[model samples]
Target: MRLAHAHSVQQSGAYVRKFGAAALLLALCSSVGVIATSGTPATAAGDATSASRARTDELTLRTGQTLAKVKASIPSGSYAGAYVDPSSGTLRVLVTQQAKAPALDTRADAPLELVKARYSLAYLEQRMGEVFAAREKLNGKNSRIVSVDVDEAANSLQVAVDGPIDAALRGRITRLAPDTPLELVQGNSFAPQRYAGSRVDDFAPWSAGVFIYNKTTGGGCSSGPGVHVGSTKYMVTAAHCATATGQQFYQGHQDVPSVTPELVGTVANRSGYPNLDAMLVNGNTANTVYRSWYNFYTASSAPWESLTGQTVCTGGAYSGERCGLVIGQTNVCSDSLRSCGLTIATGPVNTVAAGEGDSGGPVYITAPGLRYSGIVTGPVNPANSITCLNYPSGLRSCSNAIVFTRIQNILAYFGASLN
Candidate 1:
């Protein structure tokens, strides 16, 4: 997508490409205005709502820790899924049956509410596989299916589509997993939104979340956390940033007048489209990643595993630091049905969780310091957004929701660990 001027800011651009019914991941490059380079920025404080959210984040983390322990103590087959109640700010654990729940050992300070579920997470996951097997029958020439994911709260598999599904196709999907609860949702579609343009002066000992321009395409995107494959360090980015291996990426934006930017790295490997959207760049990388504008030390040894209803943040090159984004769906597929295993997060209405030029940026949590969560992939229902957040100066479609690939999946794919 080309950047157009809007709201006195240059809208960042995500190089648009189409694949079937969905937009393929785009090359990124966005020129952002001057940003803070020093001091601790506000974590969206100074208001009642922000203050409430801060408390909720702390509670969510604490409850999440408890939930982890609870799951570890129980049989996998007995558990369904878990989520933090959005309204009450309480942890809710789902079990196949109330009788399957283990003896509670809470300190009275933090209590986990167990809810009986109709199906286990494993059951829903198995059904998801079966549904994917019948993608061709469900997604046809006019492809209406946007995404398929397990809705933990609903204890069912949700199939998101842009329009109505005929009775025959519904029956076909139902037959794939008759016992599994299937939910058909309308008016939902996702598109790839890798960004183009850039940042300046991203020096050596490179950190993630800084801008890097593709020398071949002249498009740029924010970087992800650094990782190590054996003894060598490499940078992580969205695979859509470069079409092939060996392409060089430069530090800073491409539109920096007549100046040539510094070299960041070369694409060593890439996994895209139908698989996890990530790429490895052989470079001098550090364990630090950008939170807002400044770099923060990442807990490389403890990369975060995403959970439904968990809060998240992103530091896009163009969108800067945005937080209070809640995970809405996990292990989801895009509208194309090829891009699968992505996580989706939604921000406040009309707010930007991430925008073009944000792809490949770090999606992390920041309660007890920054922890890597995933890499920004794109926007959900990209065609229609409540509002667009300007990038320096331009018009671009931005949704309150974002799509990302988990960090564990990326590391596993590259046979690397967090740096």
Candidate 2:
């Protein structure tokens, strides 16, 4: 018999009774692209202010292709970073050597801009590592460091911390990467969000975007797209949901005596922080995932890489379907202990991207087909708090920004294909 997801509701009174709100959030530790090539140094475009503007709808596809071409033309050693300017719809490339910029003829679709950067991407990444090493020597437990990643636009290393760093400690870190400047920015502590699923309940041949409870860990979160490892079918989710192999998963929330949860699968493999925070649940699974309760979307077999300024949507059990989120940064590392290559997306300040119990849900694009992009890791608290939207009582935590693991990395690490 194929196992499926149980119907989940917005009413949280019962959910809160069974599992405390804070416990669910805390237990959540468990819950959870491509294009062209161009060569030739084209004449550098004017500054960002003078670039032509194109409609976002028209520029999204062209921007992806143009960025690909630019990447292909430049040597990795010379490539600093690149992204689409949200306001201008201009493709911007940062290169250590302006002479190596791709010769892109701007289409009516989108404009292209090339900027000279002081350092190469490789150098920034190396310096980021050095900073992390230096941090370890200076900070032990209770460190204030929140995240560390390359700010491609700034051509510097962004070191996010919750509190101010003393001059002595700052000097020590700065000395480690004397050649690269450090951008010490302030941010709130990021918390991993967990939960999502539609059709509150369903049977074997389970689809993605469903509520899942890890029986071993007693934690609940959402299921990601299904995947295939050899002949075995497995469901993908956040590794924090169940840390070890052989852990059992259920399709429904933990119920009282009147109800029984369905056994969905067992942990076949898992990867955690400092790596892709994902896991494979061996089960009778399908490639289908929910966009809405009654609407099912096909999960693209090919995982697409993320790009900044791209508009994407998220599917979570609690939040259902939320769109209009823009990719803010790619190749981000959350805190000193987490893996790099993570992406951060943000919506309007007052809007909610994904709420509690939304972790491990599908982050995707629906154009052409449902293209898989990534999975929700959690929310990054903004310096200024955003209004939380209405959700289940215990799951009201929301944010304009979220951190996610890129699907390409998750699949590559597992050597599996989206089912």
Lowest summed lDDT window (length 10), candidate 1: 33-42
**TM-score of candidate 2 versus the correct structure, residues matched by position:** 0.54
Model 2 Cα lDDT, one tens digit per residue, 12-45: 4322222122111111121012111121111121
Displacement of the residue 391 alpha carbon in candidate 1, Å: 4.8
TM-score, every prediction: 0.55, 0.54
Worst 10-residue lDDT window for candidate 2 reads 23-32
- RMSD to the native, candidate 2? 20.9
Per-candidate alpha-carbon RMSD to the true structure: 20.4, 20.9
C-alpha-based local distance difference test score of model 2: 0.61
Residue 293 in model 2: shift from native, Å?
A: 1.8
Model 2, C-alpha of 129: deviation from truth (Å): 39
